[model samples]
Every structure is written in C-alpha cells, then in structure tokens.
Target: MAAENIEQENSKVKYLRDKLEKAILEKCPDSRLNGDKENRLPNTTNISFEYIEGEAILLMLDKYGICASSGS
Candidate 1:
C-alpha cells in the first residue's frame, strides 16, 4: 500500500511537470528547456528564455506570487 501511494505521488508530479513544460514552450517559442527531459527529477524544471535576463524574469514572476529561483 505504501509503495502504491508513493508511485501515485510520483505519477502526479510527472504529469504536472510535463503539463507545465508544454505550456511554457507553447507560450514562449524562443524558450528552451534545460537538462535531461526524461532523466531529471520529476518535480524540477529548468527553462531558459531567449533575449531576457534570468533575474528579471524571476522578479516578474515573484510579483505575481510565483516562487522561482535562479542559478546565477
């Protein structure tokens, strides 16, 4: 039962991750996803947008109550 619950949780995470990735790519054609798509953690997504500073993007997201981080 515990294993089943864990599997379900993982599936949910993967589903949400994929959905988010799809939405971002659709909205921003110049953006690119970082790291391995299939091998990375299910809950983590790294995307880079062209012609925009990463810090600026994070700040804008924060204004909308979105929590994001930068590696720089």
Candidate 2:
C-alpha cells in the first residue's frame, strides 16, 4: 500500500516552534540551542542542558506531554 501524504504546510508547527524557541532562550540560560536560528529545521529543536542529565530532562518533559528525544 502506498503511504498517504498531506500537501498542506502546518503553520501551527512554525508558530509553536517560534514560541518555544523564544521561551527557551529567554528563560533557560543554561540551555545551549543546537542550530542556527536563521537556518534551522522547522520541526527539530535540539538543546543541551548544561550540568543536567539529558534523561532526567526528558523524563520531566514527558510528564508535561512534550515529546522529545536525546542522542546521548
């Protein structure tokens, strides 16, 4: 069976991404954002939390219904 695809762009994704990036930059001084703001994947946000465990952060975010993954 062929995979179904949607052609429409989800503007909501960009809107939410912008909001999240703004919030993180403003509030999380220890976070190191992993991409150039001017040239970044719209659907990907990678951050490294200095002095914090990635797994711990992921677990906390999961409790809040934010789906995230780590390479470490």
Candidate with best lDDT: 1
What's the residue-level lDDT of 21 in candidate 2?
79
Which parts of model 2 are misplaced by more than 4 Å?
Answer: 1-10
Per-residue lDDT value at 47 in model 2: 77
Q: For candidate 1, write residues 11-66 as lDDT tens digits.
A: 89999999999999999999999988889888889999999998899999999998
Give the alpha carbon lDDT tens digit for every residue of 1-72 in model 2: 223332234355667788897798789898877868767656677777888898999899999998988783
In model 1, what are the clashing residue pairs, if there are any? none
Root-mean-square deviation of every model: 1.8, 3.6
RMSD (CA, angstroms), candidate 1: 1.8
Q: Model 1: number of clashes?
A: 0
Instruction: After superposing candidate 1 on the true structure, give the runs of residues whose Cα lies further than 4 Å from its correct spot.
Output: 1-4
Candidate 2, residue 1: Cα displacement in angstroms equals 20
